[model samples]
Target: MQIKLRLMVALLGLLSVAATAAELPELIFPEGVGVNIHFVTEHTNDLDLIAAAGFKFVRMDFSWESTERKKGEYTWGDYEELTANLEKHGLRAIYILDYSNDLYEERVSSLHAITHEEQRGTASPQHPKSIAAYARWAAAAVEHFRGQHVIWEIWNEPNGYFWKPKPDVKQYLTLALAAAKAIRTQVPKAKIIGPATSGFDWPFMEEFLKSGVLEYLDAVSVHPYRDPGTPPETVTEDYKKLREMIGRLAPGGKKNLPIISGEWGYSSSTAGVLQEVQAQYLVRQQLVNMLNEVPLSIWYDWKNDGLDRGDNEHNFGTVTADLKPKPAYVAVKTLTHELSGYRILRRIEMDPKDYVLVCVNGSGGCKMVGWTTAKAHSVGVEMPFKSVHRITGMDGFGKGFTPKVKEGDLIFKVEQMPKYYAFE
Candidate 1:
């Protein structure tokens, strides 16, 4: 009996030692990471809340129709308030000068008034001329905003719903190039990101790159959204395809241009999928994004729209209509906290359900590996470990939580829909 007890203690000690020697993965800023704030006009109250949640940047749309109601006259009222609020909350803005104005169109009194049919890319006779004029005017606006906002995206999802005729890559590029050149001429220091394709796999991106417009822009932007319940491994593949496409477009693989997943999120409230499943997928996607090294990723919007937009849109927000953080929001907060100071050393190829993130502390240079297991799974990390810290989320498995440890590696038995894991 004494021998058995001694063996059990020895086993426990071995497990503890293994956990301690495990290496923690470093969390590095791959590029420009941020969040998207649609419906800013309504969610202005949530700015402080968003910042408090640890988001570094906010991307807002400067709707053309909203800014310029009358012909040739411009207004900055909405933008002024929004930009000021963002600055107050310590967040940067990626302003999107979007859609067509009423005057720019022949019949529509305002942009909101335009039917989906009238507003699409079927430019009237005055379309090209109006676009060019709008470009020049937009340049002035960029100069006016100046230091308050630097990154400008030409439009939102021109290849998808925004495109009237449906996927007119050439026409969209024409307008985009014209606008980009005008903006550059006015705000020389400003960085311009374009296409802002609805999905990472836009049909026109490769063609546009070959056309030399890429030379005029600073970064490429994409909006890649899969169902929230999808696995992170799937999302990581999507990002890989995106990066590869960009590489193919650049000359001699020398493309130094940055890439931004300007819009990405899954809707949890959508029909057929459970809310918890949606939250889990959202968490996983963000982790995949971090590991893949995409610079900036913005969740679609802040507050939930009253209508779920076919149920999918309703599930995408970090907060509900009342500004309460959802499971997904908590997951992101936990991830940001875990990754706050470390840099990503390398992402290891474990099973799809199990992955290891390697990181080293910035100050002490102690390396650690955070082993995150989603579902019931196991994987191997190259590093030896001395200890293990099992961190669990507050509201249960996937709601987000931090691991507390003095000095050691981490072995996380992650359940479905959890946000992420970190190594110290």
Candidate 2:
């Protein structure tokens, strides 16, 4: 009954945010949006909220230490509830196999030992035995969730603090390869992706690539977090560089491994960016990742993890801990709904402050999303469409407007926040 209620709510959202068209497929990546959810001890409202936002995927980091705390003693309390709820609400999972257990350690005992920092640490195993144990645990997890088509990301931010002590390219590749083998051994068709680094750690990733980590990966994963003010389009160059690196350094199939922005987002308070600006960042970054051909992009967080809005870490959520919506939350729903079946045709020619990206579908129809990247504006844009409606964004919906062709160009007003312009 709860799932039914959730689906009804998700369907109703389409009435307000969706375009007039036939029933479309669920939004997947390269064109769709998804969110990272931390429901370990939180309510199931996160799942409901994700479905309501029209997101198709939910990424949850499955801690090895938490599940298999005492050698073989397995507990599936919080995880089961979370995964079951996600399935119920019609969202898929990207389960991250990460962190370390005391039972699996060879050298870094203190690093692998669970502590207050285990929640934030990525103390992965070092020894062959410990690595094999992790692989076994990962395989067990894959077996348990076999039918759900869950994507397994080897670890999170291995090049960053998650690795603890310091990042070691050899160690990360070893664990990743072992986990991949174990997952494959258990579920041959399972999808394994990784090198889930924090940022573009050139040395770490290049070494991994040169060492052939791609041999075990189905997709290349990254956490491309950046400054809040950076336009999403600007980062396509960074991804392009990563692709070039893969081609130059890795083997044949490795060169073509798909990139998945498995985790990337801006924090309202954490990054010192305004909540509204955070909302705009959401649209821009997701669009940028999609345009760059990153098949999947997952926003880091869905709601504030703690009550301290003043703290940067606690303020990443698009909603408050109480389930209240932030501007970022609404923006996610609006941006995703407006993105239905739209492929980025090309970036239109525009002025400094103004930016225009055109998207079109089959049947020769084209639409655009325009924004000033800086602030709201009344700049004239050469939109080829005769008419348009504001589908969604942080900005309020605009009244229907008609564009006039001036000098062989249809001109319309563009604003700071993006607005969808569908052609008649």
Candidate 3:
């Protein structure tokens, strides 16, 4: 009887595997997924660091204050240097045009002042002339950087830190539309993204959509940063809400406009629980975005800027100031390497479990199931019962995995790896 029971269990497992295998397909790299970095100023060297860390794309801010401090007279020397460097290393730039030039001090101060009312009065859309001037400047900047950078984001977190008046969705959209129109006129082919909001700015987003603000932009941008301790289930819901908002804004495939998580990260410095939760959160978020077909999920600030490396605000970077890889950093590098050259086939959400089963198709007729945990859950991959692959830094290659299949799954657990992966 015991022998018969064991046989039954084995048969059931085999049957399940066979059934899944018939429907399973190889995994391929999803289109347009990327990482963000702040290499515009102090950490210019961090550009190479990011590239070395295996990131193909990087996002940086082109400060209006820095580029055109004076009116009509523009300087591209600094920008030129930065772009030239990125080009040399085969990295793509996603430039965000932020801050107001001194000429628009009244508008900048009024719109972005600490007090909500002061910011609103200063940044009122009534100042169409000033807004138009800024738009014109953006156009000139686009012309200057033409053919060099393709993705240009209008502003950073306009509904939050970027906007001083605090969450005036309509006014922010108005400014964005003005910028978009001006940019479109000059660089018709340029892909413009805007209204980069942080957290659950759904209320502002709803208002923007109601105003038909999405019509002017090519893509919607968001910065979804949960507290470090927030569970993966909550984060996933946040992204879902974001997607729903985007869908309502542009329905019926009218615009298959991609959503870019332009800024996201968790820092150890915030709290002890956050430190533990952030590593898993980073990994889970990346998997969710990719599986759901969000084009880009760029992390904020690749390197620490302050003296306290673990302080939540200062420690949002994937690496320390001197470039030591964090656990979150390792996880991203590993995932990117493993899932490279493969695109997502489909994602299945499991309720109560708070997990997702991501099936991917790739060359050589290989199928991979990426089990993404919502909180801190764990699972092993079955089939292809090879050894685990170890990925080192951004430039390092993937090491071979030992033959170990736990509960009918192959296990290829990792923290981070270089840009290239070598399977042995």
Candidate 4:
């Protein structure tokens, strides 16, 4: 009995010694954060809420038709409030130069959908004369908004229904080229970004690259939407795929292109996604993009459109329809606060169900964003962590929770929910 008791105690001591986090070296990089904001006009608190979320930039619409309703007649009423709010908040703007003007389109397509004056389809004119007319509006708008340092994206999802009457790559490229030239001519210091396709439309992107439309633009942008129920970290592979595509498709043979995930988001109330799950994925998506070195990852939306929780379209926003923040808002706010100044060092691959993102800051201390692949499971980590602190991945605001720990072994209850662990 004594021999057996001694062996059990010895085994327990060995297990504890193997459980702590290993101290890792710092790996350095720089990353930026941004989000897509909607309904700034309707909600008085939208801009302030966005600013409070720690977003450094916003992707907002500067609709063309609304600005120049009459020929050569400029009205700045719609934009004055927006620019004022942006300047007040110190958040940069990526203003989309979008859609069709009634004066320029000889024949309007009924298939086009307009969401609050944001003409989403068949925005470019078919007539050559109308192209020149639209160019004037493009130039005038850029000139008016000059010195605000707002980025101009020629069109939104031009390769999808956002173009309308079936996406015409040739005509869309012509429209983009004309707009790019006009903006450069009118506002020399303005930054232009585009080919804002709905997803990876290979043919559409190829046309732009082969036609040298890339040379006229500042950054290549895409809305890399994933399938429902797919992991948000799936973007890491997608990002790699995009770099490969740009290297192969870009002009001058393998030219390095600055890629921007200008718009990306997952809808809650879709599939079996819980509200809490939505919040978890929101943080994961942004961190995945950041760790992969994508300069900007704009969450597709800022607020829910209505009070229907079951409606996926309305539930995409971080805030509820009433502008009350959801769990996602808090999760994002926390992520941006902690990871904003830090850079991802590497991705630690363990089993098929466990994933880890290694990160470091200016101080050389390291932190990790880790989550389980399948469902929840407890895992033991053995490493050289001097001191380890635990924060609940989704809701770590003011409360600090206890995680299972031993002498050299720390046990974490890993789940689909991402948890941040510190090793310094």
Candidate 5:
């Protein structure tokens, strides 16, 4: 009896040591963070700067019209060049398998298709032949880039103007299913996600999810764009609703289905939003998404589309058309660099309109990010161990301010702008 009891205690001690050696979870930033880009060859220099900014992924359209000008042939010269640059910068590609070919549908190109029903052509592949052709192209693209770890997303924002004449969940599903099946069959290991719907359009998404689309998807992708006045934290409820829907609808009672913020951003145009406000939103949006357990968060428009200051679409970029860094760019760089290789330990506190998250790196270092959308107030943040620390602002507001320490808790002034506290 004594010998058996001693063996049990030794086994428990070994288990405890193993648990302590286990690694902490990884955060989504610095790996899953990305931006939308319109060009591949045009902005060669910008690619260098973007990678330097610590953007690990780039979401670009691999349009059918551009790749397949011929009936059944695909010329991947542009995409090949794009992938090469992506590899050169140590960045991954979330290449969108999207848009309709003019020859396959009508002479009207998807670029010319407008929101007006009459003006809208088949913005996506519609005809049977076109659908089959698109599936083949998707499989071929996945096969071509097999070992490169590319994420092939089916159709961008089919629930909105991007769907062409009108949004039809049934039609979109038909094409998405075919393409998904083809990629699954041809390249079984390929990472394919679908129904990249615009916003949290429940009606559209519910119908799409009902079709067992989640069975073929590695993750659900959404462009969660909100009205200019809506705060990023408001997305928490939307994510909750989405998770419930996905849980009820996913095949074989799958739980914890991953959600990706595939594309979302704020415009800095005069009629849209201010650049300074855009920067704050950028950090807040990413942090909110992170807290919600989103695996990937992509910001739309890597650079401003045009010189038109008043055009909302022309000003969503992190950088200007001339490749000048905006406050939004600096905010992202700071977030990624500061929290590199760090993962969320837990939410210390989330009420009182004050948000505090504790993050830890593999090297036993701890950091806290705190902010409040409400009026400025002081919040007590307890550290892992009592120590001297440094504070840094998000977009250059307050830096190097030593907070008052109380009972092993650091008193921080939480305000609209998110700030990072690194324990020394």
Candidate 6:
């Protein structure tokens, strides 16, 4: 009876994969907005808040050290539960196949065995046997989760301290290539992406792209983070340059690789940015990515990791550690709910400071979101609305007002914070 039940579950998984396999596109938007979360089980309530905000994906680390306690064996029970919980909330998973297993190279005891400052996260799989073991484990994982809308990333931030003992492109590529090859050989339909580099390290990215790894990847994932004062618009040119580099380095069939805004966000630390500014940035960031045609944009954090008001790392969350909704949380909830099923139609730029994004939904409803990085100003935009529509602020607070019209154009106020003007 146990064997029969196991077979039934396996069959169901296969059936689920078969059903959704064909609908997986190279680029998806609005639906691709996600958040990076820390827990899989403990704070299950976070999933409820995440779902309420209309988040479609959750990016989390599927740690290797915890899974492969005994060499040649894997315990995916924790991640299985994580994925199951996410699925129940209508969320997808972007699992980072991360870190070195302590059972192999370096022979550390556990994930928390930190000796010194530099030796932190240095338990990387460098040995030949360890590399092979990691590859086998990756293949086994892909085979096990053969479907159900999970995207696998090879490693996280290999260009930074996450690689251990300094970042080496060659060393990272060796492990990545082996893992990618192993996963592809088993689960041919699996969506694998890699070189999840920290920030936009061009040299490391160019090296990784030139190494012929694109053949195994479905998209180019990156964490395009800028300074606290810098607006998210600064990433526009970087995206253009990265696309060009991908085109030049990728092989024939894989030249037009899509980009994923894997992990990025602003912290509302007391010493740095304001919570209100962070709120504005969150909405702008998602809109910028959507306009640039980025399939997925996973905000670095869903909730603050700690209560420290001065610690930058602890304050990137959209919500507080106690599950209290911050302005950023309300902003994201408002943005997603307001712009659901809408795609950017065009951008009408009047000047360097004025930015207007015309979006259209499936039901022929037109909405415009406009903002400015500089001082507040007004711009005239031609639309099809005959009556005054409700104007919603970035925080989803506003009122109905008739705008001044001239020559079949509606004048819109573009301020630091984005506002949605629905012209249905």
Which has the better lDDT: candidate 1, or candidate 5? 5
lDDT of 2: 0.71
lDDT of 5 by residue, 285-318 (tens): 8889888987678898899989999888899999
Model 3: how far residue 26 lies from native, Å = 16
Tens digits of per-residue lDDT, candidate 6, 73-150, equal 889888888888998899999999988876777733223321325334436777798899999999998898887779
* Tens-digit lDDT track of model 1 for 1-424: 2244344434544443532232111124312446777655545568877886667778887777777777667888778777877788777788887876656655422121213333524332135877786787678778888877547888888766464435477777778778878888887777678778877654677777766677677677888766544555576676666667767776653375666778876665646355565556555555566667655677766667655556555656777877888776666665556556544455666665665555433342323333343444433233323433343323233344564333333434444544244322
- Residue-wise C-alpha lDDT for candidate 4, range 36-83, written one tens digit per residue: 876446445777888788877888877878887788898877787787
Looking at model 5, residue 124 earns an lDDT score of 67
lDDT of each: 0.61, 0.71, 0.60, 0.69, 0.78, 0.80
Q: After superposition, how far is residue 289 of candidate 3 from its true place, in Å?
A: 0.7
User: Candidate 6, which segments miss by more than 4 Å at Cα?
Assistant: 1-29, 107-116, 120-122, 385-407
lDDT of candidate model 3 versus the reference: 0.60
Residue 31 displacement in candidate 4 (angstroms): 6.5
RMSD in angstroms, candidate 3?
A: 8.8
Answer with 1 or 5, whichever has the higher TM-score. 5
lDDT of 2 at 225: 83
Highest-scoring model, lDDT: 6
Please provide TM-scores, in order, for all candidate models, with all chains considered together: 0.78, 0.83, 0.76, 0.83, 0.89, 0.89
**Candidate 4: what lDDT?**
0.69
Worst 10 residues of 3 by lDDT: 19-28
User: Stretches of candidate 3 above 4 Å error?
Assistant: 1-33, 41-44, 107-126, 251-255, 270-277, 348-362, 365-424
C-alpha RMSD values across all candidates: 9.4, 8.0, 8.8, 9.8, 6.0, 8.8
